[model samples]
Target: MTFDPTPPHEPRRPPPRSALGPRQLVGAILVLLPVVLLLGGLSRCSFAPGGPEIDPSAGPAVDAPALLRDAARLAPFAVRIPAVPPGWRSNAVDRATVAGGPGTAVRAGYVTGAGRYLELVQSDAPEEALVRDVAGTVPPPTGVVDVGGTRWVVYGGDEALWVADVAGVRLLVTGSAGEDEFRTLAEATLAGETLPAGTPPPR
Candidate 1:
């Protein structure tokens, strides 16, 4: 028998299918990860209109009286802790230097019985300067509201500011609380007494 020069013909095979390599697979996963996370986040968001409704009374209660006592000792001006009515809660208190000037600013925030927020800022700063700092800018007084015969100059519309000079310091009442709640806080603050002098705890 004659020996064949060429080997027997083999069956032709198709070329291998293209696929993502290790580096390409990692790159694709990286690109897809942010999109997946963003979609997940969007799915969890509320689509309802209007701003978020906050529960002002939800936070931890603070010892406003004790805080005010400490602030009174350190502050140049007297600090009076408001006798917040029943169901109202004090949420925060802070004592800091007046912005852009010398003097102390003692702030105590409260959540009213109706779940509205109000902040009282008693400062030794000048009326104009303190109001400017607290109000962010001195908008013209919208009007005036009387709290226990004390006249409080009003500023802004919806977000109101009721400011008055009581005893020896300026008291600013501002927040989401309604005019009535604002009046309540203002009245309470005005009615309250200044903390007694002597050795006091750190502010």
Candidate 2:
């Protein structure tokens, strides 16, 4: 009998070769990463640390009522919360004391009935300062819009502004809303003006 050098037992197939090609090998690595991580305990995986991104289409949903209630205390006058106009919703109300100055600013942010955004800012801050804060631009007042018994001065831009002086306070409606919409808000605000109802007088 001839003795064969080759073992009759099947030789190991070099640990079965991978059927995946080069590209597939890369993909397989990606697919197995999660499994490897899961098995190894994922606590060591590096990830971006921060809050989730906001979805712009969802729109900003701020708490306007709470803002108004809080601002009513710090505002110079009774914070006259205007009735929300049709299709328009107030998103936020806020008041801030002017840094390094003796003034306070009260702002109300709204998404107009048309879904455009604007903000109403009432402040005793100097005209230059307040205008800068609300509108970010103090273009020469181009014209005046008379809404109800009040007059709103208009500024031109892709953005719009309707401003007026009422009872020694500078009232500004400014933002991305159109000029007509801005005026409509001013009219509604003026018509519905009143201090927060049932607010106890300051001691």
Model 2, span 116-199: residue lDDT tens = 677888777776677666656567778877888787777765466777887777778877666677777787677764664235
Give me the runs in candidate 2 sitting further than 4 Å from their true place.
Answer: 1-57, 62-66, 99-101, 196-203
Which window of ten consecutive residues has the lowest lDDT sum in model 1? 47-56
- Model 2 residue 75 lDDT score: 71
The residue ranges of model 1 lying beyond 4 angstroms of the native Cα positions read 1-53, 196-203
Candidate 2 shows a clash count of 1
Clashing pairs in 1: none
User: Tens digits of per-residue lDDT for model 1 on 1-203?
Assistant: 99977668966665453754788778888999999999999997764332233465588898898878877777776678788788888988998887876667899988877677789999878877887788777888888888899989998844678888876678999888677888899989988867643337553
Question: What C-alpha root-mean-square deviation, in Å, does candidate 1 show against the real structure?
Answer: 7.6
Q: How do the predictions measure up, each by TM-score?
A: 0.71, 0.62
lDDT of 1 at 29: 89
